[model samples]
Target: MTPHNELRLLPWSGPDGKPCFLSTDNTNGHLSRLADNTEAIQLDLATELLDYASVLLNGAETDSEELRALATDLTEALRDTLRVAESRGHRLPPPHTDTHADDTDSPTLPAAAFG
Candidate 1:
């Protein structure tokens, strides 16, 4: 069994909207593969939605009703994408840091880099 902190965060929620986790040493296990496939599908759908949104927003005759629906879909996609990101992030190895270096010595990106 893996340590509590090292458990894999599954891509979906449990009953009553609680988070679900998996603990296994095998990377190619059944649940791991399922999570991987689900994440891929979610990301692909989000990408498709983004393209559709761009086209819809650029149209002159787009109606308020359609925009509201699009907003709802986008919100759901964003939520799923965030969950997938959190799950995968937990599975990544920890970053290495130098003990001799001060926090101020660390590199930083400009604000524009985020955009």
Candidate 2:
């Protein structure tokens, strides 16, 4: 696990390995922000941020408590920023999801080929 400050400098990647911003400052930034507030809302926000970081780090094959916390905080900030942008008419592309062609609708191969 990192000391939390260094974790902020780490980059977060989406499921598609694209970059995403998580915090305005390094891990220290997140710590500093949290230090100023201890409300339930802030704690909840922290949890949400941590969850996002876990997903990002897991996608990039990295995991740690500090990384997770930092990532989560960054993720929350990103989400809020996006929400504000959307409210103002800025749109973001949705996260990528695997969409398989309808193989069930395609003609099936002959079963006799295996026999």
Which candidate leads in lDDT? Answer: 1
Residue 90, model 2: Cα distance from true site in angstroms:
6.9
**Residue 100 lDDT in candidate 1:** 41
- What's the true lDDT of residue 90 in model 1? 74
Candidate 1 at 43: error in angstroms?
0.4
Which pairs, if any, clash in model 2?
8-27, 22-74, 49-72, 50-72
* Per-residue accuracy of model 2 over 3-109 as CA lDDT, tens digit each: 33222212224598654333433434664344323223544675676676667767865548767668566866765554433322312234345544674444455
Query: Candidate 1: misplaced stretches above 4 Å?
Result: 1-5, 98-115
RMSD of each: 5.8, 18.1
Q: What TM-score goes with each of the models?
A: 0.78, 0.25
Clashing pairs in 1: none
Per-candidate Cα lDDT values, in order, are 0.85, 0.48
Worst 10 residues of 1 by lDDT: 96-105
| Residue-level lDDT tens digits of model 1 in 12-53 | 889889988888888789998998898899999999999999
Error of 1 at 13 (Å): 1.7
